[model samples]
Target: MVTIALDPTPYHSTHSLLEFPDVAARAGYDALQLTPHPDFGPFFRYPKADDALVRNLKKRAADAGVRIPAILPVQRLAWPDETRRRAAVRNFRRIIELAVQLEVPVINTEFSGRPDELQEDSEAAFYTTMEELLPIIEREGIRVNIDPHPDDFVEDGLDAWRVIRALNSDSIGFVYVASHTFHYGDRATSLIPELGARLGAVYAADTFDHNRSHGLRYITNPPGNAVRVHQHLRIGDGDVDWGELFGTLAASGYFERDDALVVSNVFGEDETADETSRFQLDRIRQLVDEARSAD
Candidate 1:
């Protein structure tokens, strides 16, 4: 049974951290993926969760009949600067501890390196940090999945997978965010199969191909700026091909895995989050069923 979790970012502003499970339940999700939140784990900051808070959160999720399959904490594990890189490593240790306490097996995150800086430097820093963290990840039995986010040191899917593979640890895996399809070289058909079992999670959100219309879909203030733009629009609202994406996933034996995770992470329609979430759930299930049936 593939778990379809909800990313409760749309309710971050309107609801409290403790209310996320209930919010997900109300939106028709039995599982929720915890993202960075001010009260819990803020982005690029040391986690703020304590023992009491972790206990409370676990109980809340249980009460709401929601299972927290994963947590996302965006620490700069690949910072080129020594000071920032060390700080990110420290932050990651705490994040791992939190994951253990919550009994969440997966930590989905980004390769938070500087794209403006030297990619080699960032990659070196990343490996250095991983040297210290991989042992702990293995000891704790937690899977840390990395996404090659837009504007990150390695945004191309194959390149990012290569970086992950270089770590040579089964504890490290890949996160395929659908919204980043274009940035990932739009190679889901090939990428998913290449990733194989190393693909730990899939985030379902639609995004416009910036490469479309001769790269005129979005215009920046300064021409050829370093800005990389993408949207987390509802599925089918943008350019991601659901049939092809899901079909590839099925062909790669993803749907047969017990730990398979597909997250509904549409962040552009917060005004209609409840309705959009329900729609996403149904649509995702429909796509998965259609793909599986065809397979």
Candidate 2:
């Protein structure tokens, strides 16, 4: 099983995402979640970024003493429009470039329902990205893990499976987010293994609210809404069924002798954003020790 870490992007620039490695180390997490261009801004597709930015990211990850396992861009790349789709591909490539520098393990992007290309052609786009990036990812020795978020075109395991199977490449796979899976109305326990070899990693969190708006608020700002619906929450606090979650992943072949990758976070009416994450990590450390024994 793979060890889990937290996605610190919710805290944004104020916190150096790489700085969380100490917290993860303290919490006993193994990796960190990163994104390309953070991909959601109107400026996500900047053609003018220098390679220094990428180099800085690599240096930052090294300084943190943790590795970047996945790149979860905030943008929705699964689109049906040709132009926007091409732009998305370019954006994808740029992030992958940085992942190579950081020696990151996966390039994690989400598939929103709105397509910039033909829906039928999404497979083509998926392949297009793979075809273009695989050589570089392989050169960098990184894998690309695309997550199926509720806001995207492929919002669940079935769609994620279809898209991943279409690519038929080892460099690409799925990053499972539990709250997102539950939002798709299917429990993750049932989804992880059906993915088979295409399963790359799992993105786990706890939450109460269940709206995309609430999720986005969490993404833009920590502890997003007064009514938080699951972008990031500490395990066991909200509505998650942890027992079922662990059982499913174990049965899914993700955990055998018991290695797990969980990026835990909780947003609330908190003061310091970093403290919010530290608190969440502290909580998860206690919960995981309670839930599973570390051999």
The number of clashing residue pairs in each candidate reads 0, 22
> What are the per-residue Cα lDDT tens digits for candidate 1 across 122-146?
9999999999999999999999999
Alpha carbon lDDT of each predicted model: 0.95, 0.58
When superposed on Cα atoms, how far off is each prediction in RMSD? 0.6, 6.0
Off by over 4 Å in 2: 16-30, 36-43, 47-49, 74-76, 113-131, 134-140, 209-231, 256-260, 265-272, 282-295
Could you tell me the TM-score of candidate 1? Answer: 0.99
Q: Pull out the clashing pairs in model 1.
A: none
Which 10 consecutive residues of model 2 have the lowest summed lDDT? 35-44
Candidate 2: tens digits of C-alpha lDDT, residues 13-117: 554444555645554455677543332222336333356755665666566566666656643355555576668667667666655655666666666434333
Report residue 8 deviation for candidate 2 (angstroms).
1.3
TM-score list, all predictions = 0.99, 0.74
Best by lDDT: 1
